[model samples]
Target: MAQKYKYARPGVETTPWNSLDVRVTDPFGNRITFTQRLPE
Candidate 1:
């Protein structure tokens, strides 16, 4: 799933590009956040 998301672009209805936020919850009830920048 992460591989697919890496190449995905923001949809037309979404906000302007600056950064992307990704959140994931593990089975152990731990929450993780990821911040990514758009490619040049």
Candidate 2:
């Protein structure tokens, strides 16, 4: 499955940890990824 979203307004700067990518695994061994990209 695939998903996407957007934010109209964003901060000037964001923390390092704010951007994260988490890998999720299902019982069948399928993997999904979640990521967050901070403001520029």
Candidate 3:
């Protein structure tokens, strides 16, 4: 699920992330971040 977000655009959306979060920046200078809640 998280893998898809790596190439996501401004309008795209997907399931939230887990412990292993991911972030990336495109050539257009757009940044996307995927994060999830930590275990209690």
Candidate 4:
């Protein structure tokens, strides 16, 4: 999935990790991939 990061105010910067894909496993042993979009 494609991810995007946004800043709440002007002249703000976004981090590299904010636009990356993250993988996690659940208790049922299933792998899930999701985007990490964060606001600054």
Measured by lDDT, the strongest candidate is 3
Taking all chains together, the TM-score of candidate 4 against the true structure is 0.37
Instruction: Report the C-alpha lDDT of model 3 over 1-40, residue by residue, as the tens digit.
Output: 4455544434434434435455668867778776655564
Residues 1-40, candidate 2: write the lDDT tens digits.
8443232222344347676566566556666666778665
lDDT of the structure predicted as candidate 2: 0.54
The sequence of per-residue lDDT tens digits that candidate 1 reaches over residues 2-33 is 45443333332222676677766665667666
TM-score of 3: 0.39
Given candidate 4, what's the lDDT at residue 13?
39
TM-score of each: 0.44, 0.44, 0.39, 0.37
Candidate 3 weakest lDDT stretch, 10 residues? 9-18
CA lDDT scores, all candidates in order: 0.55, 0.54, 0.56, 0.53
- Which regions of candidate 3 fall more than 4 Å away from where they truly are? 1-20
Candidate 3 Cα deviation (angstroms), residue 31: 0.9
Name the runs in model 2 displaced over 4 angstroms: 1-18
Better TM-score candidate (2, 4): 2
Q: What would the C-alpha RMSD of candidate 1 be, to one decimal place?
A: 8.2
